[model samples]
Target chain A: MTVLVTGVGVVLPGGGRLADLGRTEAGSLEPVDPRSRINRRGLRYKDRATQLAFCAAEEALNDAGLYAPAAEAPVRAEIGIVVSSNFGNLDTVCRVTGTIGAEGTLAASPMDLPNASSNVIASSLAIRFGLAGANLMLCSGATSGLDALSWGRRLITAGRCRQVLVLGTEPDNETVREFTDTPRMLDGAVGVVLEDAGTAAARGAVPRLTLGTACRGGTLADCVAVLAAHGAPARWYPPEAVTADVLDGLFPGATRVDLAQVWGASSGALGVLQCAAAIGWFDGGGAGPVYAVTGGGRDSAAGHVFTAPPGVAR
Target chain B: MSAVIAGAGAVSSVGRSVDDIFTSLCGGRSGVGDLRVFDRTRYRAEHAYEMDDRPPGGPDVPLRTTRWLLAAIEQAARSGGLGDDLEGVPVLVGTGLRELRSVELRHRGAADIGPADLHFGPAVRERFGATEIHTLANACAASLSALALGADLLDAGEADAVVVAGTDMITESMFGLVERVSAVPPDRVRPFDRDRLGAVMGEGACAVVLRRSADARPALGVLRGVGINCDAYHVTAPSPAGMAAAMRQAYQRADRSPTETDLVMLHGTGTMLNDEAEATALTEVFGDRAGRPLMTAIKSMTGHTSGASGLLGLIVALRSLHTGAVPPTLGLENPVPEAAPLRIVTELVEGPSLSTAQINAFGFGGINAVAIVERAR
Candidate 1:
């Protein structure tokens, strides 16, 4: 029941290429105006995180050949979605709550209230894409991104959907910065389309990478151990919170790629961004069996093992 | 491999424990009352199912969803005869609004709610000593989804025992949104009622300890199967087709027919669209057997507990199986015409031998989750 990662899309700062994930810093990049990239018809009421997600999802869906812009694509009930974000709609929620606190409860607009829902970002993607499958929004602390991936995998493995869209988005704004303790937060979204092997093969979609073994627990060490049971990783993308010395003790001799140094604080988007980085590394002719682990703070961590598929340019 | 409910705990407006809530429901006691949690003078609707008593928690746990969650989990563990230390047990928390009330309090300088508190994983680990934690924000269907995931984890041998919980508190933000949306707020929640105005919000927390049926522990009930789906239709609207699809999926997974279900706990938000959609979905799924299952809507008594409502409904369903009586759906003076094909339990119906029950939880964003549970043989 192996799931294939057929598409990778990112709305990172500075228009960074996915191939240059760990090789370069994201720089002092600003958020991209999603208005230029996506349709503006339904963008007015969408929160920033959701807008970024739409941008990433469009690219990922197109890359997977499942969707095309203005192509009158048939609605797919077999495509599900899983979203991971801790502060996706913080600004919208704060605005609504602030309005109620300052002016009366009646002051908050009903139109903007839907955006205040924690699952708004995930739901918005489902609505725009006509994906009627299982939709879940995970805010499971530091490992949320990986948690989302796990759910996506489950959906496919359980035969609930043939392909699942997994997005990890965290919006950077004044409200999020004020409420969030994580420094250098990622300002955009990262999306990866996970398809069942049979479906991908039938559609002739080339896999960017194949998911190996993935596990999560209260700490990074626990997840690493679970994945390590399969095989030791050649390269490891450790969370920014984890220092090289600690990772050296955990996975000795493995090349450590600190993603936070490249793309700010990943927060909830850590796991998907890590997988995207792994795809980039593999595309760069890196070796197989890479481990990407997110979470080192007080919350739980998730480690996923991925390998370049056969004939993936070696 | 089957997953059984080892223990259950709850804190609703009518009662604190599962038994108390069941008794209150059987007696048709409504938890709806004055909305004193916030100033109600400014809003058209002034009543909600607000909790009168606060549960104690560790200093690290804030006093909103986290505190209630911890209390519910602790009660669940104790009732299941577990020791003080949960050790390696994994904890899953589901919520529509995860600690937004605490965030609002922090905004008003009333409390110091940190970013970590927003996600219940760290707090769950700290208080329960559980190494693995997952927080799901699937809106109203969250808790049932958690239950489904928990069962999956057990079936996958990920954990020997898992605790799944859901909690939400009435926030001024949500109240404001409901107020603005409702044309006229109903004095009380009246699910399936023809004259039902709209739903009133409630605050509560509920938890269930789940273990493999092979554990040989005394169980409250068995989770037969769960089906989840997203309508993708509208943000605020429910789809009858989507809801029926979920029920069919659940029945398929359970390997049980719709006719086997003896009771059904309706999502029944009392909204015009929600009630109509649910009734239509039930009719579509059950067909001529629509009137066979004894249907009850607990929201009429518990008000809409939001994320916690699903687990709360589940607890009531399990209690009904044990007590051989279905709780009444209060305020159902006139059944909606759409629900005529379906049998609505308006009064406490006793002396019915029940074995299987279905619980429906539909949330904003068109998220629908249906779980089927059967009595432990």
Candidate 2:
């Protein structure tokens, strides 16, 4: 049985709230409003990566309508949490290391230590939702996002979990500055609610895309070529290209508003843009086939392809 | 879905490969020696099984430990008679120190440790042209977690095969950290021994190629199941009850009863708390039947290889299954009084055709992993 993505969500460079970002169309980046939906207390406390994840997860759960009593039954003990990050709290690690090096171990704050762990995000999510099933935090540089999705699909297919929350979030780090000597780091998060297609359909859950095989490569060219050979229009987007490349790749000359100009570089946020793009096109009464590409260094890349629902484009 | 161990490799202080380590273990040799990799003159424990010579694969590549791991993988693949194109095969590498060399350089005020140190995954990816790479850093359980992830991936059909590798070498930064934790003994590792003080640090690398049973050669032992859990009890100290939950989960996944377990490759670090916890956990899971299972600790001879310990245990279990002789638990002259009345192998003991072996690894941050191996027909 193939695992399908029933719902998707994102929080990225453009906006804070799911609704605010949900209206985004693929064209150019847009400036985010400070008072947007993501300005909540708990959301504000989170680092950029955590913030993105929270937004994406919230949207996913909302779309699945899984926040009600039925989905929250006590006997539903098969919900698993799996998240992947390229750097895994690199920002917090840098802070703790600097503090320890300068002020000695005794002066280190207790709060900083827990936050520095790679599993902090997964642990926090587990605590939040009372998910006690298998939890894993995978770190494999850039490919971590796709790997997490692949693993989540496996868990669902293997009947280990009835529903799996798979999230991939990466925030800009000081390491980006230190190594690239450039300040162009993108911060965002993406999540997909994966469930067995038969089970999901029975539960009245609508799937946005039927996920296929996820593959990775050692080099960017190889990644693009392999994906393209698999019927995906894999194209490389330079840093300056922004969402223009994405919109062009997906719709060619289709009329759409470019939000990248206002949002800036989304980086890991491409997944978010794709979700928003799908929704925007659907809402705007214009669509056929839509494709999205998200890539990052550390060899991270995720691509999603889907077709519009019938009668929407007609 | 079962995954078979198609290939295995190692490079430790005992020897450069599995053959060398096994030969030395059969001869009852010890690899613990004075620490030479780093100047530990100021530290409390000055002994370690440091990898003295350049790893069997030519010159060191600055900060990347993946180079050594790749070498071991190459050896394992050659032994397993596998192909060079690891495309579409998942690569999971485990390590206690992701970039220890980078840490050392930063401590010494080096401006940059180069791209090699900054990006460790790409180094391995470039070498073998892997389709995917997953790096895990869970202290001691890193490699075991990698094995578990491999099993999960295979069961998920993410790949036809997976390469799980664990590697850790003694570094100045790691030496300092161990000294601070005070887990290192002044002498050698004496696991489960009454007078055991602490663990002896060591350096090594081990890799195993795993494939679905259908794709695996009939000769290789099958990786039956893998169980992993977080204790969430303590950071450094294990649950006094040991990893009962984790072990139960493992046995349940393996579909085996406690009495069916033929042997146990313990994660005996020789520390007082570690020994006590392991014994307690074993007793709880097996009850009176626990004492019937043949138990041994290999760290007394190989020293504690941190992330690589669990993989070494797997290698030892495979060798034991092959030879039908369980290796003795060296440095365990006087067993702890509180330990279970299990038949501890104090000397190399010839045994019946062993069908099942469990390898256990508990890491810092309360990470615990158990891997079950079944002898192939």
Top candidate when judged by DockQ against the true structure: 1
Off by over 4 Å in 1: A68-74, A225-232, A243-250, B54-62
Candidate 1 lDDT over residue span A1-314, tens digit each: 87989988988877765865867556758768898887787788788889899998998898888775422554567889999999887776778777876676668788876776788888888878888888889998778887788889988887778899999998888877788765567888989999878889888998888988877666777887887787778888887667767777877778888777777777889899888888888888888789888886788677888899756655
Q: Scored by Cα lDDT, where does model 1 land? A: 0.84
Q: Can you tell me the CAPRI class of model 1?
A: medium
TM-score top scorer: 1
Q: Please report, in order, the local distance difference test score of every candidate based on alpha carbons.
A: 0.84, 0.64
Tens digits of lDDT, candidate 2, A47-130: 556666666666676777664322244323466667776444555555545544454433444444334444556545544444
For all the predictions, what are the DockQ values?
Answer: 0.69, 0.20
- RMSD to truth, every model: 2.5, 5.6
Lowest summed lDDT across 10 adjacent residues in model 2 chain B is found at: B111-120
Worst 10 residues of 2 chain A by lDDT: A232-241
